[model samples]
Target: MAETNLQVLLRRRPKGAPVPEDFEIVETPVPVPAEGEVLVRHQYLSLDPYMRGRMSEAKSYAKPVALGSVMEGRTAGVVVASKAPGFAPGDSVAGGFGWQRFSCVTPAGLIKVDPQEAPLSANLGVLGMPGLTAWVGLEDIGQPKAGETVVVSAASGAVGQVVGQIAKIRGCKVIGIAGGPEKCRFVEEELGFDACIDHRGDLNAQLDKACPEGIDVYWENVGGPVQAAVFPRLRDFARMVMCGVIAQYNVVEGADSFGGPPGPYLGAVVRKRLRIQGFIVSDHGWPRYPQFRREMLGWMADGRMSWREDVVEGLRNAPEAFIGLLQGRNFGKLVVKID
Candidate 1:
């Protein structure tokens, strides 16, 4: 058993972009699980964009983290001890164990996985939330049809890559919008997106050239100028599934006072009869998880799907890696490997 547990605690709410100073890594004696609980030795931690919202006091679908609490995150780990039914020592599982090296928690919300079937870390990425987020949003909201044009923002990232591939599986023409030439190439060549546009350049011009048919289904991720560009080109009855808005997640607290004219935007929505739906993956995920898991495992095993990881070594590096994730510096699903 591990002697000490290291946790990354949120020192304070962030102002703009988070600095390493905003968090304090503290070491404590690993806890012993009581009844109905399991002790987890964390192996990998998943860092995602939605974590930014948890750092604020702003009202959201869930409560914000209190100052001085462990920073929240999903983790894949092995059960080192268990008082919980159906779980035992050596069981590989994943849970919202926060950003910690070890945790003692109930097995009620944890999931068991077979590391032999897929890399254990995949339980934190493609076979987990990121992949599920893509599947849920695309199938439920996008409801794409064959030959229809589907565009996804942040298309080289975890969820975006899956969104484009699934759209292609359903016979849709998939266009990916990524930050640079390298990511764009990966999206098109490796992931097989029909086209990938560099979001950093003349976005409107590039999107026009890449998606001449106009966007029929947009799995929206980064929503700022990209959404503005996509808005005008949305075909009638198009659907916009709002999965994330990473672009605005770091606008210094209390400095987010700007809303331009809504008339034109609203007018287009009415005229085009566009359907826009904002969702958090958890709600749709649990009920549909069995299907997602069965299908994802097959896709991965058959080599029809692949994913990338930008792994930062050590739990101590999580704070820096996470800040970089918000800045779009990490190339793929960002994870911290803890020994």
Candidate 2:
């Protein structure tokens, strides 16, 4: 174990898009675990669009990270020391330890991960939260059925990829809305999505061609122009799972960012009898966890499911990586590898 732990702290709030100056990297002595606590050494930190919301002081489902405090994120790490049951030194675990190289916290919330089952970092991604986010949202709210047309925005992203792939597994015709052609190709060829449209191009034209039958299930992730394009294409009785709006995460509150106003979609919703529900991954039903694990794990082991990650080295570069993520620069799940 190292004598010190390097941490990334929120130096100041950003006005629009985040800059490196908004974060300050500092080193502190490694903390020791107290009774019932375990010491963790983070190997990889998960970066998602949701972190942008946590950077602001605005009221939300979760509390904002306090100024001068470590930024919030889930981490996959190895235990350095433990004073808690069900954990021991060298045990691999995943937990909400925020942005830091090492941490000491109560083991109550720690999730034990078997490295033999999957790569350690995957616990922060596909085999974990991102996968669960896709599973619960699509299964619970979207309720897609065979031969239905499902469109997933941010198609190549952490959550979007899983949503599209799962919809495919359920026999749905999956159309992915990705940023670039490269991502679109991967979404179609690699993930088995039926079709993929580049959101940067003319989404309306491409979406019209891709889903000629109209969208039955819309997984709304990049909620901006993409949402606007998708609205007019929704079929009657369509279901929309309101996920993250990455396109507007950086925009200053109260100003038009990327999406259109609610006024435009109101009449369409009532006329079409559409069902729209917003959800957070944390609010996923506990009853479905076992099913998610059994099915997703089995799918991965049998080569029916796959995943990708865009790894950025060093904890200090997290801010830049996160900024790139919001711009749709990352082709897959984004994570910071801290040494």
Candidate 3:
């Protein structure tokens, strides 16, 4: 048996915001699993905007973490010990194992993975939640037609990047909205988007310049200014997939993160018979994991898709990196290497 040193809860119920001091690190004797359980040593920890909701005491998609509980996160790791029949000592798995160096997991929540095919870290990025989010949100909700104009916000980040590239593969004209000129260049030159507009620039003017035919499908990522800019240009009978609203995540109530008053453009949804749907990407009650894996893997193998990761070196940096992600500080998928 190996000794486990872990990061554990110090306190909960964060004030207006969270800081690193809110977390406490402690070491305790590794507990042995009684039955039907496995012990895993974490290799990579996923830090997402959704975690911010967990830090606060709020009703959300899931229950809030209790005080003195391990911080919740999804991780890819190696199984060090197992009492389960099928899982062995050396199997690799991904699960909601939280922000710790090691975790005791039940087979119910763990997913077996093969690292030999793709990089194991991909289990947390393009091949994981982000990938699935892009796939289903675009396919089922957006329903992008060939030759249609597709717009994606946060266009260089994990989800938006894949969404744009996949839209391009489907023969749609892909326009990406991202912060800064460098990210815009990466989206256009490297990712093969038809056009890339820098949101940090004059957004309305730039989008107007890029989207002459109007937006047929809008993949919403950052919701504040970008959404405002894109809304006016939506074509008749357009579709919108509301994904993440990272720009407004930190805004408190009455702060007007949506900018001034609502624009006159939303009336187009009713006038033009548009379709707009918000989704939370957990297969939307359709466990299409098998189909998603097949199509995405095929695209990856054929180089029809690409992915990037903003890998933070340690867990200590997760807070700042996550803050940066909200501000569009990260250029790709953000993850913490915690092994």
Candidate 4:
């Protein structure tokens, strides 16, 4: 068992975008598990867009973290000890174990994994949260049909990649919108998107070219300008799943330069009879996780699905990696590898 634990704590709240100094690495003795709990030695830590919302003192569906807590994240780890029944030492597990080298938590929040089946870090990306987010939002809410055009923003990221591939499997003509040519190429070539437009290019023209059929289903992972561009192109009876707003994640806390509320597109929503729904993945559809896991894992095993990870080497680099995530710096899943 590990003798000590190290953690990345929030040193100062970010004003706009985060910087490395906003997090502090601290060392302490490893914790012991309580009843029904196991001690985990974290190996891979997930960096997600949702963490940006947690950094601020703003009100949201999830509670904000206090000023000096270890930054919150979902991680995959190995159980070094267990007081919890059914949890054995050396069991690989996934849970909200935070940004730490060690964790002690109840079995309620942790799920065991078999490493021989897949890469362990994949639990933090393709077969885990990002995968579940994409699957639920697209399959349940978007309900895309065959022969329709399915569009996804942040097209090269973990969630977007899987979402696009799944759409392809369902026979949708898939279009992906990513920030650059490299990412766009990956989406088209590697992930089998029908067309991948560079959002950083002349977005309007590119989108117009890509989705000549109009957008039948839009899996929204980006807000701001991308949303604006997509709005004008939605087809009649289109469906939209609002997942995240990476574009606005970096806007400074208390910045008044932000624009006013959007004008009513009530006419478009009504006339087109579009179905638009915003969802936080965990809260909305986790009850179906078993089904999602079975299907996605099989897809992955059969090489019918693909994924990518932008892994930073150590725990100390998480802040910079997270900062990059808000700015579209990561090409896919962002993970801090601790082991």
Best by lDDT: 1
Clash count per candidate: 0, 0, 0, 1
What's the TM for model 3? 0.93
**Top TM-score hit:** 1
Preferred candidate (TM-score higher): 3 or 4: 4
Model 4 lDDT, residue 20, Cα: 88
Superposed by TM-score, candidate 1 places the C-alpha of residue 179 at a distance from the truth, in angstroms, of 0.9
Candidate 2: Cα lDDT at 282: 84
Per-residue lDDT tens digits of candidate 4, residues 119-234?
88999999889999999888778998899999999999989999999999899999999988899889988998888988878989988888877999999898888888998799
Candidate 1 lDDT over 186-254, as tens digits, reads 998899998898888999999889888798998889888888898899999999999998988998765
Count backbone clashes in candidate 2.
0
Better of 2 and 3 by lDDT: 2
> On TM-score, who's better, 2 or 3?
2
The Cα local distance difference test for each model comes to 0.90, 0.89, 0.82, 0.88
Sort all candidates by lDDT, best to worst: 1, 2, 4, 3
Alpha carbon lDDT at 251, candidate 1: 84
Model 3 scores what on Cα lDDT? 0.82
For candidate 2, give the lDDT. Answer: 0.89
The parts of candidate 3 lying over 4 Å away from their true place are: 1-3, 8-10, 13-17, 253-255, 259-266, 283-286
Model 1 residue runs over 4 Å out of place are none
Better of 2 and 4 by TM-score: 2
lDDT of 2 by residue, 120-167 (tens): 888777877888999999878999999999999998989988998889
